[model samples]
Target: EAGVAQSPRYKIIEKRQSVAFWCNPISGHATLYWYQQILGQGPKLLIQFQNNGVVDDSQLPKDRFSAERLKGVDSTLKIQPAKLEDSAVYLCASSLDRIDEQFFGPGTRLTVL
Candidate 1:
């Protein structure tokens, strides 16, 4: 089975600039998630989608962060007008179900200058 895939592995942007990351989950997976992992900290759930509908996005920062999973397949995360504190690893993960084990992508590391 194909594993989760992410791109641009790393990024550097000035504070207040927008940045985006992409992800592709495993085939046939029904659940997708985006997480933010700051240095020296565990990953924090940012958003979750079951198929094409959002299951949870309570942790997402509505003022600056947004995400979407279209066609219930690939997904994208965008941080607009980025902040210096937003520097961290943006991880994309997928699971067969909400309670199942998740497979994670390599993640995109974003740095704000």
Candidate 2:
């Protein structure tokens, strides 16, 4: 495939609500990542997964955000009790390995009231 895949291209929720986004990586890829991109700011890595294991989540808000990549292919990211600050684009990216370049999916735009 040419790139990664993501679902529910857009979502709108009020503060204190919850939302989930999904992603599917290119075949043969082994690394997946989730990023949050706020308007006027660069995308920030939220989580990284290698196969079915977690690699990094240091920048993720543990109290509100959760993510998992199952079977090393599909991934999901969730946010609970969303806040206004959570309004941003959720991007999914995948690569063959940590050192390889990544191919990103069209992002999921989230609007939190």
Candidate 3:
């Protein structure tokens, strides 16, 4: 099967602007996650969901970042009023369960000016 799919592979926006990313994970994978990978560092989990229900979001900046999984299939992540520090690569991953191995998408790179 093909890998996960993400759109707008690259994006650039000014501070305080809004941006959104889309992802479609492998079919039948129930667990989905969004991550932020800053340059030079490992990816940090932003939010996670299992079949459209949130599993964890403690690391997510709720004030500006939001995410949702539609019908337990596709997912979307958004960042509003972005800040300069928000510039990073946003990745999407999926797994059969919380403890299972995950498949990751190429990611959408965001550059906040």
Cα lDDT of model 2 by residue, 18-106, tens digit: 99999998998899999999999999999999999999999999999999887889999999989999999999999999889989999
lDDT of 1 by residue, 1-113 (tens): 88899998999999999999999999988999999999999999999999999999999999999899889999999999899999999999999988999999999999999
Query: How displaced is residue 102 in candidate 1, in Å?
Result: 0.4
Residue 13 accuracy (lDDT) in model 1: 98
Ranked candidates (lDDT, high to low) = 1, 3, 2
Native-vs-model 2 lDDT? 0.94
Find the candidate with the highest lDDT and give its number: 1
C-alpha TM-score for every candidate: 0.97, 0.97, 0.97
Q: Which stretches of candidate 2 lie over 4 Å from their true place?
A: none
CA error at residue 44 for candidate 3, angstroms: 0.2
In model 3, residue pairs whose N, Cα or C atoms come closer than 3 Å (at least 3 residues apart or on different chains), thus clashing, are none
The candidate, 2 or 3, that scores higher on lDDT is 3
**After superposition, which runs of candidate 1 have C-alpha atoms over 4 Å from their true positions?**
none
> Model 1 Cα displacement at 49 (Å)?
0.4
Q: Rate the local accuracy (lDDT) of all candidates.
A: 0.96, 0.94, 0.95
